[model samples]
Structure formats: structure tokens, C-alpha cells
Target: MADVMDIVIVASAFGMDAVRAQGHLKCAQASRRAGAAGFEVRRELFAGEAEAAPQRLRALGCAIAELGLWSVFSTPAALYTADGRLDAAALRLAFDEASALGARFVKLQLGGFVRDAAGAEIAEQTQDSNVRLVVENGQLAEGGSLTQFVGLFDALAREEHAHVLGMTFDIGNWAWRDVAPLEAAAQLAPHVEYIHCKTTMGEGARRFSAAPAADDTRFIAVLDRLPRDVPRGIEFPLDATRVEADAAHYVEWLAAV
Candidate 1:
């Protein structure tokens, strides 16, 4: 285990296709904004043929914490996409790229697959990788039911690749779905390699908000439950146009925590 207070920022929202395609310049310029400390290069870059993507990212002068290698597609619990069906070639290439740069770790999304009786959904881990992989559950369906995910994780823990693979638990997402954050954290603790902290609220309608891990009132308990040693990722959403303000917000929020 590692210190949870060693929080880092991972840039994904700003660099997702739409933002990067049209807002890249502004995005790049905004990195200097106050709250945007520890900017992270997204894993999408690995989707292309630049086998040296990680090296290129590091060369760009950004503070590299970890690079997202792959994200499984899911919206809550429904399997919108088949697991291991997305551009495997691209993911493999990306993994290679990240490993080549000697990145500390890679982030993976745990979604996209409808669990089968034999548990074939997690087949992707068998792919090449010497880098640490952090798998996160983003599309928790029915508001945080852990059944399917637990099955997946159990399989992952026994897989040959388990040595380098661990979990990325998002406290806010679980809370939004109405799960008690501490319980979820306890269930996820053993497998967690890193933490992605965010705060969310709402009932029939849902909203995702970014707050300091400590000030996220509902999730503070979850934070307390986390092992002091796990790596933390403070992934906050920012309004692209209001980059500076949002950046400052994150800085202040973190300072408060």
C-alpha cells in the first residue's frame, strides 16, 4: 500500500475526442492554469500508430503520473459494447507504447462486457503488458451493484496477469449510485491499486461534481476507509472555457482536504 494523500491529476475529459479535436490549443494553454497541477496525458493517443506515444507524451513536458491504456465501454451496468471487442490491436499497441516509455502505471476501465458463466469477458488482460494496470468500475449499473464486477475482479485476481494488475476505485461514482462509500471501499480495498476521487449527487436526475476528497461530505467516510498507502488520482472535470477558474477550484479543493 502507498499514501492516499499522494494525489495526482489525470487529464481525460479535456482530451476526449471532441475536446481535443477543437479545443486542443486552449487545452494545452490551460495546463498552466492554477488548479490543473499534475496534468496527465490521455490514453487515446495510444489508439493510433505512434508506437512511441508514451515517449512523445513525456517529451511534451507534462507531469506524467500514469497513462490510461484502455477503458471498457459501459454506461452503468448495461453492456453497450462487448468486452474485449473494442480495437484490441489499438489497445495492444497503446500498452506497448506505455510500457516503452516506462510509465509507472496504466488505467483501464472495467465495463463493456456482459459477464458469462465461464467468465470470458476479462480476456483482455491476457494481452501484452509489463506495466502496472489499474482497472476502474465506471459504469456501475443499478446504482453500484457489485455482483458482476466482483466476479470479474475475482477472475482477474487469479489470471496470469494479476501480478501487475490492480483496482481503481471511484468514490463519487459509487456514492451517486447510492452505495455507502465506505462499504464499497472495504470491498474494493484489497484489489485497489489506486483511487479516483470525485463527488456526485442527485436522485432521479444525476450530477457529477468535482470536490476535494475531504470536502466531499458524502464520500469523506470512504476516504477514511481507504488504506493510507494507495495512490490517489484527483480527476476533476473542468469547463474548457473556464480553465483557469476550474483549475484554481481544484487547487483550493485539494488544499482544503
Candidate 2:
């Protein structure tokens, strides 16, 4: 909602070793120094269960707020289970964690969501939740299929439950499922509330996230198609050795582009 594009630095972008050793509190400080509008706190990046406890998260949230930065809580949990049943436990935990962090959004994967009769169940579960719930396309075919997304949105729309959930469009993740990023963007742009900006490198099983080249037209094209007002997360790897140095530059570059 801020006039300036919100540049979010995913904790993992700082690399696992640094995040694990220094903890997400340090990473939040780096994100603020790098001029990021928001910091995405990853569930798996927490040093241990103690660091992820409610009390720790509340303290972390207070610290982050003092830095004048917003937060997005990303959990690897899925909204639905493999059997197309809602994973109430995962969803509840995600919401509770996000609330504790005072995050603006809570991101999850759209797992095994083959269909939904109506969104009443999901809407009820998410009712009164202050944090926005967003589903990201997974890196695997089971949850990343373009067809599944189209169907899911269509169904949500019919039931007027679209407001209950938003999309986290991860450009690089499409490569893992062999889907064209542009094509997916064109169809899903209307529902996207966040963008995971990155270019995938390597091939097949070796594919990994990397920063986009300056003149990468594909990256430009994808951004053009999606809503410009949404937050863009730097999910690509940054220079861990140098810590926050490259993050600021990328933040500036991404905001301009």
C-alpha cells in the first residue's frame, strides 16, 4: 500500500549458513540497512525450535518494527494435504506464527489442491486473521501445475472466496515444473499479491536460484505482466560473504526495473 515498491529480502537469500549462525534477528537488521521495505522470515531458517517459539517471535517482531520494516512470514507448510483435504494444523500454525511476528502476510504452498467445492471452509479458517494468507506455486509438479492454479482461482472466484487467499508468484519455481513463467503470469497476475523475483540457473535436477542478468528481457516481461503495486521478494541468492552489500544494490535495481 506504500507508494514505493516494497522490496522484501527473503532470509535465505543471505544463505543458510549465515542465517543459521547469526539468526533471523541479524538478518532483519541487514534487510533494513539494505533499504528493504520488508523482510521475509522463513520457518526453516530459524536456528532452532527455541528461536521459533512464540515469545522469541514476539521479541523479534518488536525489534523489526523498531527498524521501520514490515515482515512477511513464509512457511513451507501447505494449505491442503495430498488427499485434497485442508491441512488445518499447518494452516493454523502458519497463522499463529505470522500473527506472533506481526507479519503482513503469511505465505504457504498450494499442495495437492486438485479442487475445492467452495472456499467456505478456507474462508472460515482464515476469518478474523489479520495477516494475509498467500499461496505460492511449489517447485514440484504436484503443486506447481499451471492447470491446477487456473482451476483453483476459477473456483475461488465462483464462490467469492478470492479475497481469502492471494498468490505468491515465484518466477524461478516455474522452471522446476517446466511451465513458462510469462504464460503463468498472464493468467495469474490478477490474483498475485507478491512476486518472488529470481532467475533459475543450472539444468534439470541441478536447477538453482540466481540473480537475473541486467538485460534479461524475460524477467522484464514477467514483471510487466504482473501487478506493479505488489511486493517483490528477492528470493535469489545474494553474496553471503559480503552480507548486506549486494542486497541494497539489488533492492535499488529491482525497484527501478
Best by TM-score: 2
Whole-model Cα lDDT of every candidate shown, in order: 0.51, 0.90
TM-scores vs. true structure, each candidate: 0.64, 0.96
Off by over 4 Å in 1: 1-4, 13-38, 44-58, 61-91, 100-102, 112-130, 140-145, 157-162, 175-178, 203-206, 212-215, 239-256
What would the TM-score be for candidate 1 when compared with the true structure? 0.64
Write model 2 residue lDDT over 116-202, tens digit each, in one string: 724898788789988998999989877799998898899888888877799999998999998999999999999999999998999
- In model 1, the number of clashes is 6
Query: Candidate 1 residues 72-171, lDDT tens each?
Result: 2111122223453333444454455456544555655555534331223324543455556555666456313555457656654555434445667877
User: What is candidate 1's CA lDDT for residue 241?
Assistant: 83
Pairs of residues at least 3 apart in sequence or in different chains that clash in candidate 2: none
Q: Name the regions of candidate 2 deviating beyond 4 angstroms.
A: 1-3
Which ten contiguous residues of candidate 1 have the minimum total lDDT?
68-77
